[model samples]
Target: MTDKSIYRIVFHNQGNIYELYAREISQSAMYAFVEVSDIIFGERSKVVVDPSDEKLKAEFSGVKRTYVPLHAVVRIDEVEKEGRAKILPGGEQKGNVAAFPMPLKPPID
Candidate 1:
């Protein structure tokens, strides 16, 4: 990836869908996790503010890096420009799309 690449990471968190924009993303050293860093947020000087964006900014503030379980990650995309980071209720998903079940541990065990 180029230095200018911006990543859009979508993940499932406690029945909510989190959409975030970041300058960096990679496989985490931790087992079965994806590392996200350099989170991007809109300028605070704007008169119009999105509540969801504010919530997300507060949630991730002071966090240098974050790891999302591989199973919880919905999708990751490389976009030319950053978008507003927000959270959506998971139950609001349209159509028949469903998250694939992932076993927590070895079934034989």
Candidate 2:
């Protein structure tokens, strides 16, 4: 918690797992906004997660936020402390869970 560090992890809420390795690679901190199918309630919610303990707890309370190894993630993002944006990578588009990528500039671009 001294200098800003880069951390990547897969957020686990119940059985559903949203892959987030690729999105947290280069950034000092990452925010993963995922649409999870709530097994407990049978509903979907937009869960925002991050690498920092403070930021994660502040933003996500009811939702479970677990830190995961960056190597474990497929998609990563070098985002600010705000952990801006959310992506729902599966489920019906009409439903709360939708397949979407993090809004970031391509490396080649």
Candidate 3:
């Protein structure tokens, strides 16, 4: 891959869809988590004021590396160019989308 290669990572977080771009993506030492580094953000002057993007920026600010649970990851794609990173609110019309259901436990005596 070239130095300018960008990777788009889409994941589900607390009922929201998070789309982000990074320079590097790799398996993390922490079990079951994917490591994302070198997050890419467009130039502040050229970018519009997007609440979703702003929220994401604040959430990831000062973070050098982030570990996302494998189960939460929706997709990962390597593209020739990077796009604006934003969050999509999970509204009532989520449609056929469903999170991986966790197994229930039996009642303890």
Best by lDDT: 1
**lDDT of every model, 2 decimals:** 0.88, 0.34, 0.84
Candidate 2 local Cα displacement, residue 46, angstroms? 16
lDDT of 2 by residue, 1-109 (tens): 2234333334432223443322223322445433222111111244643344333334455753334433334444333442322333332237476333322333664
Give me the runs in candidate 1 sitting further than 4 Å from their true place: 92-97, 102-109
Q: Write the per-residue lDDT of candidate 3 for residues 1-109, one digit (tens) a residue.
A: 4668799999877767799999999999999999999999866885558777788889999999999998888889999898999998754446686556322334779
Per-residue alpha-carbon lDDT of candidate 1 for residues 1-109, written as tens digits (9 for 90 to 100) = 6779999999988777899999999999999999999999988999998999999988999999999999989899999999889999866447788567422332565
Q: Rank the candidates by TM-score, best first.
A: 1, 3, 2
- Candidate 2 stretches with Cα past 4 Å from truth are 6-72, 85-89, 92-109
Question: Which candidate's TM-score is highest?
Answer: 1
- Candidate 3 achieves a global lDDT of 0.84
* Alpha-carbon TM-score of each model against the true structure: 0.85, 0.24, 0.81
- Root-mean-square deviation of every model: 5.1, 14.4, 4.9
- The TM-score, computed over Cα atoms with residue i paired to residue i, of candidate 1 is 0.85
Rate residue 21 of model 1 by lDDT: 95
Candidate 2 or 3, higher lDDT? 3
